[model samples]
Target chain A: MKETITLKIKDLFEDIGNQATFVGSFFRNIFRNGFEWNELIRQCYLIGLKSLNIVLITGFVLGFVLTLQSLPTLQQFGAEGYVPNMVSISIFREIGPVITSLICAGKIASGIGAELGSMKVTEQIDAMDVSGANPIQYLVVTRILACTFMVPLLVLFADAVSLLGGYVGTSTAGGMTAALYFSKSFSSLVFSDFFPAFIKSIFFGFTIGFVGCYKGFKANKGTESVGIAANSAVVAASVWIIILDAVAVQLTSIFVYNQ
Target chain B: MENVIEIENLKKSFNGSEVLKGISLTVKKGENLVVLGKSGQGKSVTIQCVVGMIEPDEGSIKVLNKEINELDEQELKDIRGRIGFLFQHAALYDSMTVRENLAFPLKRVLKVKDEAEIEQRSVEALEAVGLADAIDKMPSDLSGGQRKRMGLARTLIVKPEIILYDEPTTGLDTITSKEISRLILSIREKYKASSIIITHDMSCARITADRIVIMNDGKCIAEGTYEQLENSSDTFINSFFKI
Candidate 1:
């Protein structure tokens, strides 16, 4: 039993090391001459534009529900006026970044993982390598950059929609106006609230792309491994998203909150 | 260059198991050398080394008078650009139209900026393989034989100096296999390209090979014309030729 535990621990570390090396390759190939612009634009369209409606709907519903849930609880203590402050702080600091990132981990990570996993199994990657084309540059770097840039943009879009939802939820009690709701929301938000979330979203974006690409590219050699790669990518990316969020919150707490 | 490729005492092992053991072979300019071996032997590994896909742990491979391992990254890419590798599966990018697939190497390796030139060469390449009608179709739409032909056309689009064919006719019906073999023969003559054809397909060897080398147990066990090899007295070699 002890030996088996040691082997499993060793395997996990080796897997992490392999993924780090894969990321290192992504950076190394970025400096090579042939940048794949068309592929990058296509990935941006697929990852960012296509995901817009879904992220918007999810974000709005999340914010609306959080406000409704918090209203009755805070009303019991005569803190109804603090609802906007509560919504703004919660959405910007934690809910917006974490929920949007998890959504992306489910959607884009699985797509990239399955696509590259199938390519690897069919020998298309080897064909590219032997034909003197840079598969790492054409496929991995383009997709990673697309996700890294676009996911942050998606999170910002989601935040706007969510804040609107919060205002709508606030008006349901028949007392506040849109101008008042937004003003109160903005009044409570400082730079620290947005900045930490923005930083976390960037880290989440990198995690999603890196984990997806690594799982897909280094998948075991078989047709079934394609399915395994896509499933594992979603699971791994989701977990990493939360893990990084926790680390970001801790860092934000230690540095800013303490000061 | 008298010898387009020269592999000297090449060896390779994977996970402590040796696949190729001190194998050496040569292919002269414009000569087609077919390597005949059983399924699990290292015939494919040897040709893969010639292209620098598999690093030979113990020896050296020279293509066009330059050592493969000695070349830097750009040099390796340049050398690979000058040499074509036809994988067994044809490996046409399924996402791409046949036309786009053919044009890929030209755009990336040759860096041909003129679209007209790219299209013309692509059309010409398809025409050479009689796959012009497949120009707009996806690779998934192609028959196995058609895919192989398209693969050959993609390789020929670059007009490589040497080509490495890894089991070009493995899964085809016998007639289609022979047709592919003859196409390989004609393409060789037309391009004036040296080639290393790796196969278990005897009919393919008979049609495409200018000379034949037989590999077994990770070594070249016999070498001669196809007819000379067929008449050999060695029992292990004869087992392959026996009808």
Candidate 2:
């Protein structure tokens, strides 16, 4: 039993080492290939363009629901006018980034994972290598770069849409005009709220893309591995986003309070 | 004949378990060498090692008369441009049209500047593999045999000096396998390119191989002409043939 335990520990260390090596090589390939502009543009369209509608609808619904749910509470306190400020802070600081990332973790991560995972199972990656193509450069880098750029844009769009929904909800509550709501929301949103959320999203993008690409690239065995990789990509990305968000929040609170 | 690829005493291991143990072989510039092996043999590993996909722990692999194991990743990328591969499944990109699939390596690796030239080559490659009409179709729309042929077309678009076929006839019906074999033969004849085919199909080996290398237990067990292997009284060889 002791020997078995020792062997398991050794195996775990070896696996971690192997993973580190693989990730190191992947990053090296990314630098070596530089950036592929055309591929990046193509992927941006896929990740950003195709995802706009879903992000918009989800963001709007989230904002509207937040406003409606908070209405009863704020009205009871005779602070219904604080609705716009509250909604804006909540959407921009937390809801916008978190919800957008979750949606993206579902959409883009799964898309990338499934696409690359299928390619892997079908041996297209091997085909690329044999054809003198750098599969990592061609596939992984394009995707990671795409998500890195597109996710921010998606977050931006989602924030705008959600704010609009917040305006509609406030107007329906019979106390705020669109103009007044915009002014209140904009005034309440300091750089502290926007920048931290925006910065956290970049990390979220990186995690989503990295985990998705990593799962798919390392996928072995057979076709079943593709499905497993896709599923794991979503799960891993979602978890990483939440973890990163927590770290970001702690870091932001320290810095903001100090300032 | 010029030796395009030479492997000497190659060894590989996965998780400390040896897969290719002291395997060695060579392919002349225009010769088609079919590597015959059962499912778990290291046939695929042999080709991957030659291409530097997996590093061998021991021995020398010289491709195009250069020590492949010694080359940097950039150098390996350059070498990869000169070789093509057909995977077991027709590993086509589901997102791209057949035309785009053929054009992918051409544009990315070859850096073909002229769009017209890229298109012309893609069309020609599609024609070569008998996938001319499926240019606009997605890979998902194609039948299995058509998908395989499309894969062959993508391989040919690069005009590689050597083609590595990994289970080229696996999962195909008998008719499709025959067609693929015929396509492989014609491809060899047309381009005069050397090829290393990994397959368990005896008929494919007989039809396409100039020299046959049989692997068992992670080692090369026999190397001979088709007739020589067939006439051998060795139990393993005889039983393999009977099967």
Q: Say which candidate scores most in lDDT.
A: 1
Q: What is the lDDT of residue B145 in candidate 1?
A: 97
- In model 1 chain B, the worst 10-residue window by lDDT is B47-56
Compute the lDDT of residue A110 as modeled in candidate 2.
Answer: 88
Q: Candidate 2, fnat value?
A: 0.83
Q: TM-score, chain B only, every model?
A: 0.98, 0.98
lDDT of residue A111 for candidate 2? 82
Kindly list the per-residue Cα lDDT of model 2 for residues A111-175, writing each as its tens digit: 88888888888777777776776777878788887888888778988998988998888778776
What is the CAPRI rating of model 2's predicted complex? medium
| TM-score per model over all chains | 0.96, 0.92
Interface RMSD of each: 0.7, 1.7
- What DockQ does each prediction reach against the true complex? 0.79, 0.70
